[model samples]
Target: MSHVFPRHTRQAPPVAVAGDGCYLIDASGKRYLDGSGGAAVSCLGHSDSAIIEAIKTQVDSLAFAHTGFFTSEPAEKLADLLVANAPDGLDRVYLVSGGSEATEAAIKLARQYWVEKGRPEKGRLIARKQSYHGNTIGALSAGGNEWRRAQFGPLLLDVSHIAPCYEYRERAETETAEEYGLRAAQALEDEILRLGPDTVMAFMAEPVVGATAGALTPAPGYFKRIREICDKYDVLLILDEVMCGMGRTGSLFACEQDGIAPDIACIAKGLGAGYQPIGAMLCTAEIYAAIEAGSGFFQHGHTYIGHPTAAAAGHAVVSAILERGLVPRVREQGDKLAARLTERFGQHPHVGDLRGRGLFRGIELVADRDTKAPFDPARGVAGKIKKAAFEAGLICYPMSGTIDGKTGDHVLLAPPFIIEDAQIDELVDKLDTAIAAAV
Candidate 1:
């Protein structure tokens, strides 16, 4: 009987005692390969010496510093590095404790930016129905994961959910990938016109849809059309990269591959590489200038916003990512992983789709390959796969409701950047065995 609340009420998880390389060790000395990098948070693997040393040194010197009173060295340096490497026009960073907080701040910041710029009526937000931003009240409101938002519907703010750029299921047989992408992006324009562009503040989306939709990459030219629409309508573009950013998709920012920049972008997960709880909401110079010129404050604060220890950890993690040339390594290893997955699961009857970019991959299961129909929801395929995988000593993210909130199943794979070629085989083998046992 444990007093601490857990995500699953019926079953308790093993007590993880240590992590070495990409494997986590339980108290019983069992090792589980981190196939999904613990929800894609540990990009540097579990035992990163540089990050550990940085955290220790920072805590030994100065552990905490409230953002209200003073700024810390690590925070400043980290912000500078992030801004330097961030998408074009994004010039500022607002540190937060996690992904949810970063998204909440982004939503509020967008609203505030419109208000300060004499467009207070522009309060409506538009997101994709298959996307997920975060879990906080504001963040949840922006997210379109129906299952997660089902219970909190009454409390959520009004947000418009347009069609996601999911080429796998949504694209038509007659249209080319580029044609489907443009057609999908047209949904945003249609929604913006329906809501009256002046009444719309921001359009939020993930460059690569993770978690809910299982690493759903957009079709070619999708984001370019999205960017054009946002520009034409004067609506801010907010890209939520909480799960797919920070080198998870090979590049430091997932949007880089998309070849577009957002007015605001939220990033976390791999930023601290599981060494610290940290996330940041980055904004364009234009948006930052609006707040600076009007209110002189963004109207957001958290006690731990600029915690020195966390900043130190982030700085070290990012430094390692850049200096150690891990981003290129992510691309190289990601290709190998994809090739291996394709070779293994391409012909598997249950595996319908194998898609994604870099290291963030998704395997969608289907009941009928020809029809691409999902297994019945009652079957609990996702849940069963998760259990079997864990029991088989492999940690992967398996979630239900890939098509919508109620149906479809997919397994998301986001291994660490440090994973070796041999480890990739191990990951795929364990997952193969797990799927066999589960199905």
Candidate 2:
């Protein structure tokens, strides 16, 4: 019997022994294709010698350095590399241990920026429904997924929740995609007004919604209008790219495709490529300058915020992504994967919508395709699909509560950027088998 606390107490999971490219080997030598990159973290596959060597080199010299006293070379270089490739106006990086820490920092930074600017009343945040930022108190409060916050209601901050820009289910038949996007974006403006724009500090959202909503892509013009609204209201825009950024969406930053930059952004997952646990929160020059000029300190940090070894791993992973031209490869392979999914499940009675961009994709399962009705929660469709896929030597992300946090299901695919054509075919074939067995 093992003393380790697992995610689910009722079931015993297979012991993963090793990773090779896009596949994970279990103790029994079962090779399971890493179809979801272990929650979209491993973009360079599992056996990248370059990243491993970088970690080894850094640990040989200095493994860790507390940020309260000094900063390491790897940390400085990693921050510079991230800001150099980040969206416009984002000039500084606040390194953290993982996605939750990054988002938590973004929230605190937004609040502090307002206080420094003499707007102490601007402490409230506004985020869209069905979104997942992170699991920390601040980040969880900013996320609008009801199921995640149900038990922690009293501890959550009072954040205004607005409707998501989900074109598939919310868009009317009369409106065009662009029109629907604008109408959806209007929710932010409406919420700001209702909450008194002066009281709102920032609006946070994922560039491409992940986890809670799968790879839900924004409609055309959605984020551009959102940027305009934020500017008009003096509210900061914070884009959470924890799961979709770092060349996973055919761009270094997922917001690049939307043609707009945020005042602050959070990134993780692929930042360390599974070699190390690292994340960063980036802010505009103006925001950084505000804190620098006021208290000279942001007033928030963790012991492992700038672990030197993790920084070295992140630097190497990012360098590999850019130097090897994986961003363009994501686009090229993403198109092929999308085409294969369409060809296989386009007309399937149970598959409702196929959507996403780059290598991130989602397949919403529905009982009635014509009506877009979801399967009953009691049926456990998503859980069954996940089990079937894993049993069939595949690892995919299938989650329930995709629609409103309790009523829908979706299978999210985010294969490593190095996945080949043969692996793509294998993924689709195994997914087909899983869906057929589950639904």
Candidate 3:
């Protein structure tokens, strides 16, 4: 009987005692490869002495300080580092505890920015189906995951959700990739026109859709069209890069590959590299100026906002990523990872699609390759694959509902930036066995 409640009540998971590089060791001395970086969080892997020392130093110097009164050195330094490396026009940063908090803050901040600009009527948010922002009410409303928003629908805000850019399942057979990309992106324009652009506050989408839709990357010129649509309507563009950003996609920011800059961006997971619980919301100068010039305060604050210890960890983790040239390393190694996955799964009957960018990859599981039909949700394919991989001493992120909220399945692979070539081979081998057993 454990007093600490777990994510799953009936089954108590393993007690991880230690982390070394890309492996987590259970108390029983069993080691498991961290193929998904623990939900794409640990980019620096485990046992980073620099980040560990930074956290300890900050704890000793100043553990906690309310942002209402004082801002600590670590917090400021972290913000500066993030801003310096962030996308163009993104000038200010707001620190939060986790990805969800960062997303909620970005949503509310976007709304408040419009209010400050005397456009309070622009409060409606638009997002895409098969997308995920966060779990909080506002964030959940922005998210389009059906299972997550099912019963809670009544409590959620009336945010409109359009189609996602999932080429494997959503693209028509006759359409070219570019044509599919344009058609998929055009959905946003259609929705905006139907809703009246002035009433729409912002359009949010993940650069590479994570969690709910696996690691779905947009097609060529997809984002450019979306950017044009937003600009045409004076609607704000908010890219939720919480999962695929911070070098997960082989670039510092995943949007860099799309060749567009968002009005506001929410990034996490890789930001602190699991060294600490940290997330950040960054905005353009225009958005910041609206709040700075009017009322002069962004109405938001979490108890742990700008926490010195988390900030110190974030600073150290980010510095370690840049200083060690990990970003380029991801690009180089990610190519190998993708090549290996393609070679292994490209012909596998159950593997409907093997796609993604950089370390963040997705393997779509299907019942029939010809039709791309998903396995029955009742089959529990995702959970079974997860358990099988764990038994084989591998830890990969397997998710269901890759197509709709209840239909498809996919395995999301996000091994640490420090993962070795040998480990990559071991991961694919173990995954091969796991998928065999699950299907």
Candidate 4:
């Protein structure tokens, strides 16, 4: 038996031997189309010569440099590029290894900002229920996924979880989409008041809920209201785009489409495009200035905080994203993908909703179409669909507990921006087959 620790101990996974474009080849020579980009990380696909060469050149020249002693060229360049393209007021980048680190840094940075501003009592954090930030203890504490947090309650910090802006399930029949968005956003205001706004340091949420809720896009005007609320209460707004940013949502930042910017944002996943492990937490100049003027330090870091090779990969990946005109291409191709999904599963008996923007789309499943009832959690609809899709040589992301962390199921599709029209059809066809087989 293999000694390696696996995510699922009962199953032995295939050894991936090679990656070509959007497909992965196993040791047995079986090819599986990467329909979900391996949890939406591979935006440029597997065989990008530019990124690979950048990584090689960086390592050959200078790979390891402690951030405390010296700043590397690639890290500086990557930070500049990210800040240049980031939302307004987000001018600083705290580089980390992956999504969890980015989020952990963001949380700590928020707390530090409050302390530096001479309001140490503003230490409380607020996150939305059914949202996912990351898996590290601090990140997990900030995330509101009940299932992921159940076993670790003793170690978690006291963070408040308000209702997520999941309009499909939470919006009332009498409300228009815009009205529902404002109403949903009102939960943040309610939580702030309940916690005493003066005690709250920051409010964290995924601009588009990923992982736990499967690309649950916020209702129209939801984030705008959220921004206003944050500003009104002196609470910093933090948007976690680990799974939906870096052109995954057809824009460099998913919040761009919502016409708002956060005081702090955490991004990874697609930043290095699976070429290297890298994530970054960006904050407004005001937050940075607080630390600069007060403590002259943030008082937190990791050993590999600014790995040069990873920075080089992120720089090259981002350069390609912007220079190759992939952003607009993502919009064009995303429309095609959405149309194909609609054509294939819009009216299926088990498919209840098709939602999302850009290449990030989600298909929610239901048992009773009219009533919008979920399948029994014990049935494992999502798990069976994932297995069926993988066996059919198509890789997709399906998860249960989409609604309230226990009831709903959804398949998240986030193909690479380079996906072609023909490949879109192939993805949908394979998913249809898998859904039919599993459901």
TM-score of each: 0.99, 0.99, 0.99, 0.99
lDDT by residue for model 2 over 382-418, one digit each (tens)? Answer: 9999999999999999999988989999999999999
Q: Quote the positional error of residue 45 for candidate 4 in Å.
A: 0.5
Estimate every model's Cα lDDT from 0 to 1.
Answer: 0.94, 0.95, 0.93, 0.93
In model 1, where do residues sit more than 4 Å from their true spots? Answer: none
C-alpha RMSD for every candidate? 0.7, 0.6, 0.8, 0.7
* Candidate 3 lDDT over residue span 1-439, tens digit each: 7899888888879899999999999999999999999999989888888989999988988999999999999999999999999889999999999999999999999899999999999988999998999999999999998988999989999999999998987788899999999999999999999999889999999999988877899999999999999999989999999999999998899999999999999998998999899999999999999999999999998999999999999999889889999999998889999999989999999999988999999999999998888999999999999999999999999988878788899999999999999999999999999999999
What are the clashing pairs of model 4?
Answer: none
Clash counts for all predictions? 0, 0, 0, 0
What's the lDDT for residue 13 in model 3? Answer: 90
Q: How far does residue 244 in candidate 4 sit from its true spot (Å)?
A: 0.7
Which run of 10 residues does model 1 get worst, by summed lDDT? 130-139
Candidate 1, residue 413: CA error in Å? 0.4
Residue 197, model 4: lDDT of 89
Full-model lDDT, candidate 3: 0.93
